[model samples]
Target: MESAQRHLRMALDAARMMIWDSELSNGKVIDSTVKWFAAGTSLLGLPPGDLSQPFSTFLQIVCPEDRDHLLDTMQEAVDKRTGYEVEYRVQWPDCSRHWLAAKAHVFCDEHGVPVGTLGIVWDITERKENEQATARERELAAVTLRSIGEGVITTNAAGVTDYLNHVAEQLTGWTLEQARGLHISTTLKLIDDTGAPIPEHAALQCLRLKQAIGASSHNQLVTRDGRHVAVEESAAPIWSDRGELLGAVVVFRDVSHERKLSKQLSWNASHDTLTGLINRREFEVQIADALHSAKQDNHVHALLYMDLDQFKIVNDTCGHSAGDLLLQLLAKMLQTQMRDSDILARLGGDELGVLLPHCPPDQALLIADQLRQSIKNFRFVWDDHTFELGVSIGLVEINHLSKSMTELLIAADQACYLAKERGRNRVHLYQDSDLRLARRQGEMLWVSRLNEAFEHQYFRLYAQPIVGLCGHGGGHDEVLIRIQPAKGELILPGAFIPAAERYDMMTAIDRWVIRAVCRHVQSVRDSLGPQQAYVAQRQPAPAQYSVNLSGSSLSDEGLRDYIIEQFVEHDVAPEQICFEITETAVIANLIKAQDFMAGLKALGCRFSLDDFGSGLSSFAYLKALPVDYLKIDGVFIRDIANNAINRAMVKAINEVGHVMGISTVAEYVEDEPTLAVVRELGLDYAQGYAVGTLRPLSVSD
Candidate 1:
């Protein structure tokens, strides 16, 4: 027994030496003999528990959250009779929480009876905290990816989609399941703004270079519907925690709405709101392009400047509504007459411009003349009122002699002025000398004066009388307009009318004339009693006044409304009005003018074709014009007694008018011989100074 005790003591000493020198000082060991029990405790630390208690009882002091897992690990080791390992939370003496890793090996007797266990415990608190923090970071990363407004997609180096966020799914119309592992190009349908395919190489460049692309930077994406969506996008290389590149991440946003808005704003800036035609700014751009093309191709073109004659009268008399309608009609007519290659635009008000590409001087002149003829024949009617319109056109051809767009326009404008001067409803070609003088005179001065004339009431009305051809005693009056000049003597229609027309002042003038005529009728009506009233009514009463209209006015669809308003405002009966139009005006826009006249005629007003022989007068046109009276041209009447040609033409015209049940009037009847000739010719009325001079009626008349 003494010998056995010495051996045991030697073994204990060896074990102690081993434990003291080794790194695992906290290790414990137990004997397998049933009769012998052993326990080893750490000297470094221990929780405040009964040291004599079983190990399981001591483990119960660990944190409640980790107790179940630790218990299960210990039970498995005991049941298997094998090595055991566990990681669990522990409570320190100070109530602080800690993580511990405990490893134990179970020992059994020869008969498989459990005897003891050996283990080592280590404090793993720092590692546990690190793991928990990593878990939290991963959760936060996932949440962030899902919450972003822009689409987020991750792809492998091969450009295959690996992950997609909800926003990406919405933007691409593809779910994460559908996009996963698919080729990005095929799944996203990425394209350029012009619908061209975006190559995988470009995407790789963005990913590899870690660059960002913006919508204004020209990044584009295509949607499932084949619509190109402008996009602002960014890409960056995706990396692992180890600082190694994994793949790439891309973020993109749809900018289609913004792009559309920008385009709309651009369009509004360059186009007219009312007419939908190109605005002045756009016109300038087009002109510049045209000039450049002409210079490059060595081509010739023409710029036609058009002015509406007496347009203001329609507006003033009928109202602005009629004036707007007239402008629209004129625009349509100008468009109709122009070639497909031509560009026609309303410069403003009654001023219009036409650009004719590849046209030479001669062709330009021809076009201008056709335009003039068209304007000369237009007839506008408002309610029971009919008005005549005339257009003056100036044409200039682009040649080597032309220096710039402005110069060409100036030349064309000067020619247009000449057309008005020569008598409105005519076409004039630009001359170099005319342009030189126009530039020197700075004729824009006239434009300013015209604007002032309407504002200051510097316009006046003159009258011409219409007498009965068979000496019926009483005569009718035809109203004429004359403008008073600021610096010179009162200007005749022949002088400043051209300037007024060019400047779009005619509509205002026409309005004034209508108002003046209505006032005159009011004044005349107040003075005349019932006896004179009948005579007045029968003898083309002063109540029935004839007013001329511009071609622009005739084409105006709203003319009827304006006339009705005017008649209502003036308290004049529709029958008390007679609207005179030229035959040329009727024939030019026969369809439009006929429609206008028919509308007015429905209101019980009368129509007369003035200067019947001067324009394209046909029996069909005359019948269609719905005129109650036909005025013979004064040219034929001036020499009617002697000139057989004149007499024959007059006789023929009279016969045609009478045959059509239209009353014919002979103008320029200065003497008894002219009257006698007109009487023999079966003329209806005669108007000239020979019958009576035109004079303003006195308040007592």
Candidate 2:
């Protein structure tokens, strides 16, 4: 007995190490190093009253779900000297859980007959965690590469392209299968404006320099089938852990639309419609620049603020159509009169401003006179009405003594008014003091900012927990979007989404959110549990996510396909994701929303009607739309504990939803009482401050 105790003591030297030894027939335990597996004490199987049956006590600690498998495996190897090994979870004496790997070998007598079995138990909780972590890291890395909007390509040291993503294939007009083993020079054919091939390869340059290189906007890709696409590309050398060069990874984005729209959208955002000229906002910007030049470089510039004479009379007598025609013709006429460097803008109404850089006061007046004469000579014949327009020009000379663009503009405007008062067709020079420019920013700036954000990957994703009321663990977290400005400030979607929706930028934002969420889910899936965990009977750990879509997203003809493609690329099961659409959004574009919902549902995704009761015809649309969840609006859930009407409304909604075979999620639950009420009302999930505040999901998560 003392010898058996010494063997157990030797095994006890290692933490969490345990041993089972049989010194006699029928395999009685000599000793146990772990108290949790103490002899004659039932930690899981037999009651404490039965102390003689140590094996029965051991059975109590093995997790019931894993016990049968462990026993079967051990019994199979009980006759062999090769022994047996199995990993299974166990419940400790204190009710804690742990994973243990047991390795056992059957003891043999001198006559080569089986006697008893000896086994060692090792705590392998860390190893299990490490395996899960490794799985998550691999999944995350894969999804991140696949979900990025840009195309990625990797090449060997010899500059041969070996990989291409879906976007790259579409952009370069070559499939990965066809492009494999092709040289970068052949795969990427860049042409300049003069129709000549670019001199050097970006990938080669990165390898040679051992750094990063970028492609210029002046370069255009001549596709395999001869389509010319403007692209922006960057390449960096891939390195091994030991500081050796592996190859190069080239990332490129199809900026053909961006290049075209940067010029077109920039112009339309800050220009006049009736005339091809800058608008009031743009004119103000030029004046500010002219003011700065005058103050710093001592350079002189001139501003001409002009108003069309008899424009109101033309509008009233000849109708506004004739007035618009006359304005367009006058704009063309003024364009011919200004120098190449001069700036012309239709400020507002019938007003125009011309900025002449490095021009003296005399030259400015002469130019203004020329514009007036040109306008007077031009005649517009719209239908049968022939009309002539004249200009009253106000001129102001900006020098080192000039104050602000605002003061200069006002002085020039006042001079133009004086010219209107004097005779109405001549140019007048103004002499006045200057002060700062009045600023009024509009929503167009947000569109430009969003575009820039997309270009630079400046958006962030956040998540809020949607706790499950039932115990089986079957709810998805709601993903939220946030913007990171260039200056490093975090801006919530509420501050910018309205502008995004107004400018038709929601489609792009939606794509970004979906991709980010896919990558996020892929990387975190292991720790959160397998996406199909709940489906497995023995291991039921549910993990899923929900993402919101904008109303404008329904208008995107390709959104459904894009989502399916993302799921495929990220290797995510559609059942793991639920898309949330607002009631107002669904009703706004009912047909499109229905089509989108049906298409995604066909792909195995679930849908939820968010803010479900906000619309007047919520239940009517609810019948039309097939949604898995009906999220009760905060108005009915926020104070349901105190407000009887809210409580009644919530109850009605929950009952109706259940009748329709849909679950109910109550939002804005802010206290224990409200949570209690929601649970009492049979709500499936509750989300808000009391449940849990939103937490930012890191790349690590």
Candidate 3:
């Protein structure tokens, strides 16, 4: 029994815990494994004491802050004869403080009744301090996320949203209280532009790839309210100290406004400001593509170069306001005149260009004339000052031969120059012939002489008698114009006409001829006393004069008013007058021609389609033209008696003309056989020398 007591004491001394025995009856310490004296006292503080004392309470060593609760719990355990555990601060006699975990239970004497309390204590201050520091770090991290300006979302290892900072809540249109514990995709919906959820948006890719990743520019974010915002996204995985994947974080920002500005700038760079049309630079870009297509597809396209005539008059007469209004109105008119497939642009001041993709030269010429005439008839009633304008058009076929943009431009410029020269308001086909080449190169020399002739009135008129092959009506005389130089013989119209037309002097020339014809005819009528009138009536119908009009005059919207003004000025009767227009001119300005013919025909005047069957598209314009005569083109009629094709073509044209109720005239009849053939074709009139010799008109014509 003594050895067992000794062994119990030794075991208590060797324990890591401080062992204590207290009397439950008085709440005083009876024994301790270590002596409570001097420097050996632990856990509870003691100032000084004996190894074995009657009264040395452990309460004195317990910190005052924790003493009451620790004592109460120990007493309760003693009363219930049960075990208890507690942690409390220990204030030692050396003025040091520490934490202790205490465990106690009531012990029974040999009679099995509670007599004392036994307990164990451990110092746990280091562990407690470490736990407090870890808690502070967590709180600091949460505050940092909340304070940051950029949005942040954190998900758990299972890809569930566990936390959201203040900024993240606003960006995602959600709150931490609402988003917590939901799947990341549900709380922070990321999508593509099409509104489909992005696979990378789940942020699991970051974990799988073990690196940061980003969304494409097309990525978007759908907010909780269901509004979609354009966004740039980036994501990275959270990690543990051991380099294990813990969760993920996503970051994003909106970019809708940025995109809009970019697109607006692009549009401004390519569009015109005044007319809202595509500017010249972009038009040339489209032209390059068109030219490339023409070459690669083995097809043809046409370019229309237009110059508005008399536009400056409106600008000079009225303020620039009227001119601007004219341009705006004409731009609208020209746009309406083209097909939907065609492209139109204001090339610059008073100039417009059209791109007719896949359109042949024939149709292009028709379109140009249509635009010309449409404007001619358009009456500008601007604030009590009505104005009319004309358009001169140049056409060129875009083909493999058009090697460069500069070449195409040069061709278009040349053609437009010719159109203006021949008479404004006509479509001049661009032909690379020797004659045209010479006209372009020889322009400077001709311009001065033509001007000098106009100034000096060095121009003369001739007449060709139209023999009535049908023998039922007296046909009129076709009047011709010639230029008489001061130093040389009379000049054929062909020599100076091309230059005159190119220089935009045709309107003046045509006006001069009309005035002269009226005066000369009036003189003849006055010369014929009543007896001479009977002699003049012996041929057939009255001698109404057939006069030629330049294409430029046709496009002059004021030409009709000007013509009426001239007739009043010259005392010429409208019934005794007929106007001749070539096939190219009529077709080039179809609408203008149609309106012009309609206007004049209403006044009992007559119109004739000159040089018919010269173009492949003569039949197309014949139905639209209100004409009284179809002068078969000199080419088909020149030698029809010898050429089978020419005879066949003339026969066909004559048939069509008769069907249309138009009389046909055969021109360039150099020999009798051609005249015989013309008569056999049931021709109404023949104007060639074979029918009658060309004569200078005298008082008796």
Better of 1 and 3 by TM-score: 1
Root-mean-square deviation of every model? 28.8, 30.1, 32.1
Q: Each candidate: what lDDT?
A: 0.70, 0.78, 0.77
Worst lDDT 10-window in candidate 3: 31-40
Tell me the tens digit of each residue's lDDT in model 1 across 507-597.
Answer: 6666667667777766766678989877766663332567877656676666778788878876667776778877776776778888888
Can you tell me which runs of candidate 3 are displaced by over 4 Å?
1-172, 179-249, 317-326, 433-701
Best candidate per TM-score, number? 1
Relative to the true structure, candidate 2 reaches a TM of: 0.39
Q: Using lDDT as the measure, which candidate wins?
A: 2
User: Tens digit of lDDT per residue, candidate 3, span 1-701?
Assistant: 99996786566556546655455454322332223333224545544344433323555666787777876777677667788898888777678988888677778778666677666666788877676545444643764464477677777767788777777788889999999999888887888877776766646777678788865467777899988877776677776533556677776667778756776777777766667677778878878988999888877898888888888888888878888878777778778878988988878888888899998888888887888899789877677888877888888889877887667767887888888878787888888762367456677577888888878877878888877886847678899988788889988988888878888989988887877887786787677899887775564334389999988889988888877876787566687789999988988888899999999988778898898876678476677778899888999988789899999998998898889898888889878898888888888898877877767865222
Q: Global CA lDDT of candidate 2, please? A: 0.78
Tens digits of per-residue lDDT, candidate 2, 1-701, equal 99998776666644556554443354233222223344223323234332333444566678898888876776566545448888888786677777778777877779866566677666787887677556544443563375488777777778898787788888888899999999987787778756897777788889899998966677788889998888887787765433556677777778878888887988898899789888989889988998898999999999999898878888888788878877887888778777899999998888989999999998887888888888888777766767778889999999999888887888898788778778999898885432111111235767788888888877887788888896624766899888887796898887778778777889989998888888876676545555555444344334478899998898999999999888888777787789998989888899998888998888778898899777756476677787998898998888788899988889999998989998899999899999999989898998898888888875432
Clash count, candidate 2: 2
